[model samples]
Target: MKKKICVIFGGESTEYEISLRSAASIINELDKEKYDIMTVGITRGGKWKEYTGKVENIICDRWYDDSLKDVSVDLGGADGALIVYGNGKLEKVKIDCAFLGLHGANGEDGTVQGMLKLAHIPYTGPDMLTSCLGMDKAYTKIMLESAGIDQAKWVTVNDYDRDEIMKKVVDAEEIFGYPMFVKPANAGSSIGIGKAKNRDELMSAIDNAFKFDRRIIIEEFLSGREVECAVMGKRGVVRVSCVGEIKAANEFYDYEAKYSDKVESKLIIPAEFKDGIEKRIKETAKKAFIALDGKGYSRVDFFVNEDDGTVKLNEINTLPGFTSISMFPKLFMHEGFSYAEILDRLIEIGME
Candidate 1:
């Protein structure tokens, strides 16, 4: 019998829609001849529903109606599905492995991973510790710095310091200077990112950022080329895809640029760069992946200062965008791996 792979997407995250797109990409690429595919959708409100149609159909158009299903597991029950309160009835669905496509909080931050671990189900992507570490910018930065990796200077803010946050903002300016990037420390797709060119912008950005996350981070913006590398694991060996460059039409690569067509963001596979710089970036990306104890697959982003040739680690997406046009898949595709092949490889490695 074919193994059932549950591709989970959506959550209480700003990237919920993007997660849907990512799941669609994964579902399209999964080999139906080898494995049985099950698409599960988690709404922004945290409700879980089993998608009836194929992933592509659901992504191209919202095909699945709200099932009003609530996914829950009982410790007393076996590893199979316990109950899903939907259609005014309780249902059970068996899942062999989960191909996680959920991004941002409650999903990518290790919560779902922990749940799956407890349920004794095999899931794709990083384990709990790595997922948690990758979600928090502050923790990831500290770990990267300790590993001798370069990153932008930054300051963190939490809810308790609302009154004192202004003072901390001023201090951040002194340390990282103006033209800073204020963002929710744990958000992805640049959901709550703002560029602050002055004190007013800085304060406003901080407030806006706090709206998304209780903890925020202010980092010095580096004027440089943005590049990303995709890494995949086979057994204990990790291989890096050819680097890709991102050219965004917006002030920065924000949600619009990422998901919508409003902003043009081009991807140049095997990005043209000085041989030495390219080598360094590829090496640094692999090192960053290992430092975070990442597994299955991940995308490591970086900012390279062309003037002095300094490269700074931006962040890592444990669960990156997987659309055909998305950077991670594009990188691997350019490196001669078809989309279906990439998905198969991920599932195979995950089986280990």
Candidate 2:
């Protein structure tokens, strides 16, 4: 029997558009001979709909239509099912597994995973705790620190009041000195990330970051080569792919530089590294994945200090982008897996 695969995307997160593109890419690559595919889109307003539209519509932000059926997951039954109800009609669609093409916030950070768990449906990516930890930069850092993984020095802020935020900013300035990077603890695709070279920029950066998440993280700016490695499989038996480097068109790899077609961002596969640095990076990547008790797959980022070759762990993306230009699939492609093959492996692991 063909496996019934539901590719869930279009989350309420800031990375919603990226999720659409990622889901379309995955849906296009999935073997029609081996699987029965379904697409579920979550609107920005948090409505779940079963999208029966062209993949092109997903890419062009035209997937939403009146034809879409209002949907919900069946958490009350033993059989894993998706409940589609509209116009006084009800239907149940059995899902063998869910390919979570979601990024950031509600979908990626454990909300959807918790629902799938309650429904007893196996889904791609890590479990609820791991997803929550991986989505929150503060928790990721805490986990990495406990594992003794080398990373940049950082601090987290949770207070929303302007006076309290400014005090925290002063403390951060004293600790990290001049230039620093501020980002939301729970955002992705560089949605609310900024670099502040002075106190005014720092305050502005904090204010902007808090707009996306209640908590924000500030890290000391480290000048290094931006590199990343793709990891897969469950904890203690993970596979690390060859590294890739990102050459951002802007000062940093922000949301626009990451997704916009107008900007020219270059990605170098098998990114050049000196001597044993690549090996160390791959090792660190595995360590970071294991630290999160990662499952299915993730993309681990890092910064390789050009002057000293120090590899500082950056972050782990549990549900990395699956777009044509995404680093995760591309890095695995360099490691001898085709895009479809990568999906096959992920689905197989997710089922397990």
Candidate 3:
């Protein structure tokens, strides 16, 4: 019997469109001969729908309108049919496993993962605890710092009011000075993220960040080449991909530079490094993965100074983007694994 695979994408998160593209990419790559595919999409308003249509529509954002049925992942009563209800009709669809291509908040932050766990369903990406750790930038930084991992200077703030936030920003300025990076602790694709050079920009950035999440992270801007490494594994055995570099089109790799076609971003495979730097980064990437008790696949990002080869871990992506131009797949491609092969490995490990 062909395995029934559920590819869940789109979410109430800021990275909703990105998830659609990622789900399309995975759906296109999965071999039709080995699996029966069901595409599930979550709207920006948190509506769950079952979309059985052209993969192109999913990628182009047209599937959102042509969605056929409303759906829910039924975790409470599991009789093999994991998804229930559609088009106002009661329907039960048994799912063998799920490939979560979601990025940012709710979906990537352990809510869906916990649901799957309770449903006794196997799903791709990290487990619930690891997902929470990876999605919350402040917690990830704290855990990694506790493990002695090198990271950028940062401060975490949770006050919702503008006045309270400004006071926290004042404290941040005293420590990190100007040109700070402000980001929502739980957002992705650079949404609700900004660079502040002074008090006005700082205030503006904080307000923008609070729009997406109550928790915000402020960090000192580190001048270096943006490098990333992809990791795959479960249990104790982890494989690290070759380091890749990013050249952003904007002041930094913001939302526009990440998704817009007009604003181009360059990706350099097998990023050049001094004798020990590459090995160190690869090792650090693995250690960071293990330190966080990561399960399934993850992508660890970093900042590397070209002049002195200083390395600072940026963040961990439990469910990294798998779009055509995403670095996760590109990094592994350089190591001789095709995109399909990478997906196969992820599925196999996720089921294990």
lDDT of 2 by residue, 118-140 (tens): 99888999999999999999999
Candidate 3 segments exceeding 4 Å error: 65-67, 78-80, 86-89, 160-162
> What are the per-residue Cα lDDT tens digits for candidate 1 across 108-171?
9999888887777778889999999999888898899899999999988888988887788878
Tens-place lDDT digits, model 3, residues 199-262: 9998898888888998899998898889999999987999999999999999899889988989
TM-scores for candidates 1 onward, in order:
0.94, 0.98, 0.95
Best-to-worst order by lDDT is 2, 3, 1
Better of 1 and 2 by lDDT: 2
Please state the error at residue 193 of candidate 3 in Å: 1.2
Whole-model alpha-carbon lDDT for candidate 3: 0.88
lDDT, candidate 1, at 278: 88
The order by descending TM-score is 2, 3, 1
| Candidate 2 backbone clash number | 0
Compare candidates 2 and 3 on TM-score and give the better one: 2
Model 3 Cα RMSD, Å? Answer: 1.7
Superposed by TM-score, candidate 1 places the C-alpha of residue 160 at a distance from the truth, in angstroms, of 1.0
* Better model by lDDT: candidate 1 vs candidate 3: 3
